[model samples]
Every structure is written in structure tokens, then in C-alpha cells.
Target: MIKTSRKGEWLEIIIPEEWDGTSVQDLFRTIWNAPKKLTHSLRMEKGVRINGQGADWTVSLNQNDRLDIRLFSEQDFGIQPSYHDIAILYEDDHLLVVNKPSNMDTHPNSPEETNTLANATAYHLLSQGEYRQVKHVHRLDRDTTGAVLFAKHSFIGSILDHMLEKREIKRTYLALVEGILKVKKGSITEPIGRDRHHATRRRVSPSGQKAVTYFEVLKTDHKQNLTLVKCFLETGRTHQIRVHFSHIGHPLAGDLLYGGKPTFSRQALHAVKLELTHPFTEEKIICHAPFLDKQNIFTGIDPYSI
Candidate 1:
């Protein structure tokens, strides 16, 4: 029941406990504050066990038996909400901006039918009784939370997609990094591509497409070596921030792909601000989301603290 993960805060386990099937949930409540569902927090999401084997909750528990239960800090099958129900930061006839949370895949995936922000936004549109299309302008990484845009119609969606292609849309992110960067601000220009064996992963490759990221170290703790930095995207690529930072040997905290530990369950990157021209209005629209304190922008630990 105890699985080790660098990205996890605690271990989740289920073993023999002196509680009956009917009262197991209550016992869980007494010992740990968790949600009602198990799959909710991939780790803390609980299952039934009897006699050191996986079973249904209908099985009874024996007295003086050893039971194991560990908590996956950020993932709790129903403990704390994994994501905010999409905070509508801005909305117009053509578009909507949402304050996204970490830990959620932007869209649905195989066997993991967890609710997604896209689905939630689509439902919101349906709630208004409007048949308008809610097309995602772009997607953020599953564990990277931040500002996201949706187009209410195909026309606007197409326009926004073009804007992204032409680099007309500007995105800014706030991230918590592991160490003090020597420079105050700089650009990371690199080519990135897929890792052949790890097809789901990416790596810095000269043969890959052009990618650029600009970053500024806003603050740092000499003691902790941890720095608070802001990043600007020149070319939006999958895992750009995580990859760029990792390529420089300072992956953002909790970003597993580039060697971040599960010190935090979610990547410490937030799309804090964005700028672009409205498709129809032709006016510059700017939106800013104050830093989400949840990601720990900068801990007082120095890079050497590790």
C-alpha cells in the first residue's frame, strides 16, 4: 500500500484496521480528512482490503490487526477539491478566460474520465441555453495551472489559433524554481523534441522545433537558494516551461518530467498573465491573475538546500 514517489508528499495505504465495513468511512474520517471516493486522489483514493488483500468494503475487519493508510498530500479521493470549478476571469461574446488549477488534465484521457475544465466550460455554455461552441484556444499541462482561453465560436477559435501561430498572443508565467539563477533575467532559446523511448516525454534537441522562454528572477532567498521567477513565452510548445527550465538544470518544483520531485503534487508554474488582440473588437485585451499562493512561488530554501 505504500508506494514511493518523489512527486508525492505522503504514502496512501489500506490494511487491517479494527473497524467494520459499515464504519470504515467513519474511521477514515476520524483518522484522516479525505473525500468519499477513492479514484478522486489517485493515491489517497481508497479501496477496500481484508487480510492483506484487495477486497470490497463489505468485508469485516478483525481486532488488533494492522492497517496501513498514508496520505497523498495533493491527491485525496475527495478530501480537498483538486481544482476550482474554473474561475471565469474574463468573458465576452467571443471568448472566456478561466483561472485554471493544477492536477487536472485539460481534456479527458483513456480510463481517466475525471471532469475537465473544457467539459465544465462547455457545461457552463449549455447552462445559458446557448448552442455556441466552446473551443479551447490552447491547453495548459495537466499539472501546470494558470490562465486559459476559450472561444465561444469557431470563427474566434480559428482567429485565436492563428494568433498563437503568429506569436501574437503573449503569455507570462510565475514559477517556483529550485535554486538561485545567477542572472536576474535572461532568455532560454532551445529546440525540443520527444524522447523516443519515453514518447510521452520531451527533451531538448537541436533537431526539434524552435522554442524560446524569457525569465526574470524576481526574488530569492540567500538561505534557501529558492528563487521566484517570472517567465515569458516566445513560442508555445508542449511542456515548454518545464522543459526549458529543466534544460537549464533548474526544473520548476514538482515538475516530474524534468527532474522535479513530488515535493508539490502540481508543477509550480502558473499562467499568471496574458495579452492579445480581440478578434472582432481589434482592441488589446489584457488579463492578469495574481499569483496563486498554493504553488509556493519561492520557498526560503537555497538551491543548495537540496
Candidate 2:
């Protein structure tokens, strides 16, 4: 594990034996894969130091050397802080995972909109004296409830964005569909495109981007003709789960946009778990959020147990 310390506005890291003789430039570019713009800004702002003194970016680092980077300098939260309560699932210096509730958008659509998970997260950080901007790594639909990941700093955010692009981050979802699926386990490989007729709708079109969804049926309610399923995504797209399931003739219950019955309010889908390798410590991190079955859509079904 990497040893890190926070001193005022700077974050200190002790060089490990594995990283011995690595140049600072390689650390930022090759190892961390930081953006060129951020690297330029760090160099221009003199935001990096070694052994308590400013050091050249090309200099090689030795084991046990103290490397300091100004990561926590005072900054705006970007979004207006909303004082609404948010449930934190996991927290660390680099990232935060929160259990997002239903009926709230992940981020604001406009500057005037403050009732969002991003605004609430900003307030949470502000209360803790963290002035860093609130940066969400990914977003869930407004009605879909689940675990959401947020990066505390831009450096880690860029790395996480890359991880997500590489499909290194695993997000599992629990949903209740309208009908019982014939297959217990299956994968949906389809291309999803925006619906030209509807502004917020997406459909499976050949001209669209690639989307893949894998699902397993956990439980089925024969009486109500509802199936509880756990879904995994290989590609993240707008309404991918809903679109894929609907394409297979099992639209999520209460999902009106996809031709589902109004058995409940909103879509019966929840982001149940998020798993990833910690960028700094390289530790396997898993975050789980409780399923929000407000209308008892999947009565007596415990998502955690499954």
C-alpha cells in the first residue's frame, strides 16, 4: 500500500520501492496517465516538489523520498451546495461513493438547479472543510437509484474516467421487469441510438453506438408476472438497461417510456453495487447500495442476500 499524508494544501506521498528510479514526468504521464493540460498546469504552477523543495520533472525519484503535490488548494465547489442529506457508501481521499436516492438528478441541468446529488455532495464536502470541486465520475438516470462515484480531485478524476473507458469499473444493477424471462442468464449486444422523435428516448439502431448488457434472473413472481434480475453492463449508454430489456420483451416494471405497465412509480431499477481497484493504494474497493423498493415492487426479496 502507498503511504500518503495531507499537509495543509499539499498531499505528501512516500516513494515505494517498486517505483524507484521513476522520473516525475513518467509518474504523471506514463503511470498516472494524467492529461497533458493538467501536467502543464502543474508544472507552470510549481505544484510538485520532492524532499520539501521544488524539483525538476525529469529527475528520477528514489525509494522513501517525500513527493508532495498541491492537490487540495482552495477551490470553488463548482456547483451550488445543497444542504439536502446524502447517504455515503464509501469514502477515501481520492474518491467518494454515495447511495443516490430516487427522484433526483445526478447533476444539475442548469446553474439555477440545486436539488441534485452533485449539489448535495458539494455541501457534504463543504461541511467537512474540503473546498475541492464536486466531480462525479458517472451518472445514473434521474429516477434510477443506486451507488454513484465522485472524485475528490481532478487528477484522480481523469484516471477514473480512463478506467471507466477501459471497462475496469464494474457496476451491477438490480431491476424488476414486467414479465418473466425465458432465459435465466443471457447477454444483450445491441446498438443504441437516440430517438429522433423523442428528445430523451434511445432505441436500438444500427447507426448507434455499441451497447452490451448481461443479466441473470434472481427471482420470479409468477402471480404478478414480474422477474427480479441482476444486470451488468459492458458499455454504459443512456437508458441502456431499459432499452436492452425492453428490446427482449421484458421492459422494466413502471418504465412507461419503454412500453412497461404502470405497476409502480418510475422504473424499477437500482444501482446495487460498484467495484473497482483503488488508483493510489491498488486495493480492491467494493461499494454496495441497498435496493430502494419503495412501492414494495419486489416484496420479500432482499437484494443483498442474492
Candidate 3:
């Protein structure tokens, strides 16, 4: 996943044999689905180049013509490094993935906040001579622990934003919910909207955006009245898993915000797996985050066994 904050970046691609006869405009329209804004921007500026010369939408392509396009760019946010620990899950020239701990915000919500995953990642990158700003692709609640991906440049981030819109990125979470659900497996298709009465709460509403979550019971502890489940999200929304499970009377353990018992300090949710295709390499990448050892949430079973 090419989640990043950098913009005005460039990408180079070789025209394939099958697209030899297609015009540059056709290629952008059909193959890349270039947004109108991008196409317009490229048209106005010398943003597109074929081989080594300036090219436009009307230019014809060949078997090995190189095409370069400039992607959208955004101004620097100027977030500073906090020099905190960020467990590096994967790193490369274009991307970085890390395991974010609970009690840490993914990114600072305000200018006054500095202790966030983004700030820590900035510090780490700077230590390695990465002077560019940090760009995170997704958001995890302050209490949600799991794999968060970042893009080192703006072009990669743009690709990732498209992937997110296309539902190409997959995230799997392990949750310990309060009750042993009657159904072993089920799907929650609900519309989630901000709670009108409470500024920070969400609820199922007819006018809300569509949200879907699929859950499978991994283990059940009837003695403790807790159930370990694997959750797959179909839509990325604020507190989707917590709110959906709570709506069905099985709020996550320690999720007091959603009517769950405070068995742990925070919500009993861990983003265990993330899978996506690399934007540049086209290779499938999968990342996993191990459960926090000290939590003791999985008291009766070895988490590895599951």
C-alpha cells in the first residue's frame, strides 16, 4: 500500500506491447483511469513525457516508449519528530510499515500534539537521512494496535489512495469480545453515522454511510464469557468493528466506549494482518503484528496456536 503524504511526485512506466497503438490520452483514460484533475494538470504543465521529450494526450505510443506522469502534490504539513519507538514491520525506499502500540495516536490531531506514530516515524526516517515529510495512509484509533503503512513519497501515496478507494487493501483484526456470540460466523452490514447527540460517538443510522464487517469465531471461553474472533473489514470507518460488534450485543472486551466491560485498559482489538500489492513492484506484501505479550488477554490459549 503506497500510503504517503508526499505529492507532485512522478512515475515512469514502459508502454507494453499490447498498448503500442494507443494514444497517450487513451492510455491515461482507459488503462490508468487518470482523474480529470490530473489529466487537466498534465495538459496545462509539461507533466507528461514520452521517451525523453515532452508529450501530450494526442501522442502515439510504441512497443517500448517510456511514459512519465506527475501525480498530485500537497504542501508539507511540517510535523516534527518526537523520537519515540515505532516497531518497524517493513521498510523500503518507497514505503514503511510499522506496528503501532496502544495508547498512541496514529497522527497528531492538532498542532499542539507531538507524541504520535507519525512524529516517531519522522524521527526514525530522519536518523536514516530521510529528510522528506512522513505520510500515513490510514487511521487507527489511539487504542487500536496493529500494522500501519506509510509512503515515503507522494506518488506512492497517490497510488495507495486509489487502492483504498478500490478496496484493494485488506486488513484483518483479532478481537476479544465480551460475550460468546450465538452465531459461530456472521456478517454485520450496518450504516454508521456520527451520533447527533454525542460529538464523539457513532451509531447505526439510516442516513449513514455503508459499513460491513465479517467475523468468524476463532475460540470461545464460556467460563470467562469471552470470545476470540477474527474480524475482516469491508469498509474502513471510524470504530466500525467496535460499533458493529457492540450493536449486536457483543462489544469488545475493555471497550467501555461501546458498552463493553473494562477487562483491559483499552479496546481488546489487535490489527493482526495487512495485505496489499506494492504500487511500484506489483508484488503482494503481507504484514503481521504479534500480540502484546504483557496484556494477558489471551489467558487460556496460546495466541500462536490460533
Best by lDDT: 2
Residue-level lDDT of model 3, residues 28-115, one tens digit each, is 6765455677677777888878876889578679877877766534335469777887789888767889899888899988887889
Q: What's the TM-score of each model vs. the native?
A: 0.67, 0.96, 0.84
Q: What tens-digit string does per-residue lDDT give for candidate 1 at 164-255?
A: 87788888888878878998999999998888889678889989989999999878867755677888888888898889888888888777
lDDT preference between candidates 1 and 3, better one: 3
Best by TM-score: 2
lDDT of each: 0.65, 0.90, 0.81
For model 3, the superposed segments whose C-alpha errors exceed 4 Å read: 1-29, 38-47, 68-77, 298-306
Candidates ranked, most accurate by TM-score first:
2, 3, 1
Decoy 2 TM-score against native: 0.96
Itemize residue pairs with steric clashes in candidate 3.
Answer: 3-151, 5-135, 6-154, 7-73, 8-73
Which 10 residues in a row give candidate 2 its minimum summed lDDT? 297-306
